[model samples]
Target chain A: MARLTLDRTRQQALSVSVATGAYGISFGALSVAAGLDVWQTCALSLLVFSGGSQFAFVGVIGAGGGAGAAVATSAFLGLRNGFYGVGLAPVLRPMRGWRKAWAAQVTIDESTAVALAQPAEDLPARRAGFWWTGVGVFVAWNAITLLGALLGSRIGDPADWGLDAAAAAAFLALVWPRLAHRRARAVAAASSLLALALTPVAPPGVPVLAAALVAIAAGWGHPRPEEVPE
Target chain B: MSAYAWMWVAIVAAGVLSWATKHAGHSVPESWLENPRVHRIAAFVTVALLSALVAVQTFASGRSLVVDARVAALAVAAVLLWRRAPFIVVVVAAAGVAAGLRALGWG
Candidate 1:
């Protein structure tokens, strides 16, 4: 599966980084409007480093929910990053000490997704994808967050720019290539519908978490096609 | 504690939880995770969850389903992606369509 060139991976990683990073402008503005000062909003991006969770935090707060709910929601949304870390652990193995600590900080959605999209055997490309994507997103997201926070509501509606769609578009692009398998397609459909149906009732992150169960459930039935040996 | 005080507490708590989750994955035994079952779940969970995120982001507004330009953009983006267009093209086309629709007040 080592099909993606190092150069190609770098290009993909960088492009997605900039696109998703620019979307951070919207997050910064929203967080401030939600009553977080510029520094606190910046701190969230600096410290949390997970865009979905960061947005989930401000969204809850903007709605006047208590900080407890906000934290809980964001934390739950962030649980996906942990799973990403797990999936990539083998590929990113042998990390130690401060390097490991730093890696933990940046083991985010875009990084892991880009890295995993690499062929499993292309270790160098995988590592390159992970590090470049993570670092690229970090620098760009933080820099833009600072800019957006300072500008505040003057940035207008980031949503209207279709940035809200941009993030989704990036993720969809990642999933698009992997949809070749029947099981993958089935699981995607089931999970998406589950999440949609639950969106009206379940709290923000719960639907996604519940949808994750579909993967484990599918595993029981499909029996790992790769293991069967063609 | 005021909500502000709790906010501080919660932020620290969330950071710790997130960090721990990252580290724990590294420490997990390789053999334990090597099960193909584990691999399948790990791989597909991302796809499912990501699509789920997109769904909620584009269509849901506080427990209610609403169709808007975001959804329309997503559909166009899907077409671009399926045709193997480059990343920027897919995103730009998607956003352009959504923006065009909104400008016309269709979304």
Candidate 2:
């Protein structure tokens, strides 16, 4: 039974890695459109390694936002990864030095989700899920990012290629799965409205931060229809 | 600084902060993260930020808002998502919509 569960976990992680990593093409192409050189686009994938943050960084920069705003927006988008690390720590066990650092770096949404969804008592299965998904995503994401960057460069005006729309679609897809919760739906609606309202008056990145305040506010306290699974 | 120079700085700074945020979770006492409120807030924050990105990407151009092919493409993408299409298919369809609209000179 344990072996079977472990195999299933691995299969889940593998599929998730491919699905999630493939989105890096959008990230890669969009980063170039956002004005990153091919190498810079690749570096962002290698270093930042989070989908939402990478997109946020490029989105802000592409819109003529300053470096401060770009970094700030990307950082805000990345905050969830930390929480994932917190959730995964016990499952992953203690580590030291480089191994610990690598583990920390790979604690992302797909990895954490795959790990946590495993049978709670199966530490080995959970760990297998986390590492497989994380490392697999890392490799695939970086390689595809390079390919997208190259393709994006030769594609002419981004608007002509509808890369801009693709960018929007990517963001929508990302938030789609999370909107199943009632409160999350409310937060998303509120954030979208707040962002739209602030866009004209505010600086490029400020509106997004302002939108986050809505989530923080709504998320405080509890039991407004008990929170649903993420 | 030049735009590219600024991008480099942003890339490095964002990278360090992102890594640190992830590591902090592992290093912190697990008890700290046990709060339901914290998890809820984090999850909501993810939804909030991504939705905001969707808005900005779809509608805003510079400091102003505009209606364009991107909007139509977003609508298409939303429909595909409602049908549970694959991510690549959703993305490609979106790009195709926008690109096709632009070719028609209709935006």
lDDT against the true structure, each candidate: 0.79, 0.78
Write down the TM-score for model 1.
Answer: 0.90
- What lDDT tens digits, residue by residue, belong to model 2 across residues A108-212? 766776676565567898899889888988998899889889998554454677766876785576467657767778888899999999988975557776765
Off by over 4 Å in 1: A1-4, A222-224, A227-230, B1-7
* Model 1 pairs in collision: A1-A119
Evaluated with lDDT, which candidate comes out highest? 1
* iRMSD in angstroms, per model: 2.7, 4.4
Stretches > 4 Å off in candidate 2: A1-45, A48-100, A103-159, B1-14, B25-28, B84-88
Candidate 1's residue-wise lDDT over B1-107, tens digit each? 67666776766776776677666765667786778767667767777776677677678877889898888899998888778888778877877888788888887
Estimate candidate 2's alpha-carbon lDDT, on a 0 to 1 scale.
0.78
Chain A TM-score values, per prediction? 0.90, 0.70
**lDDT at B65 for candidate 1?**
91
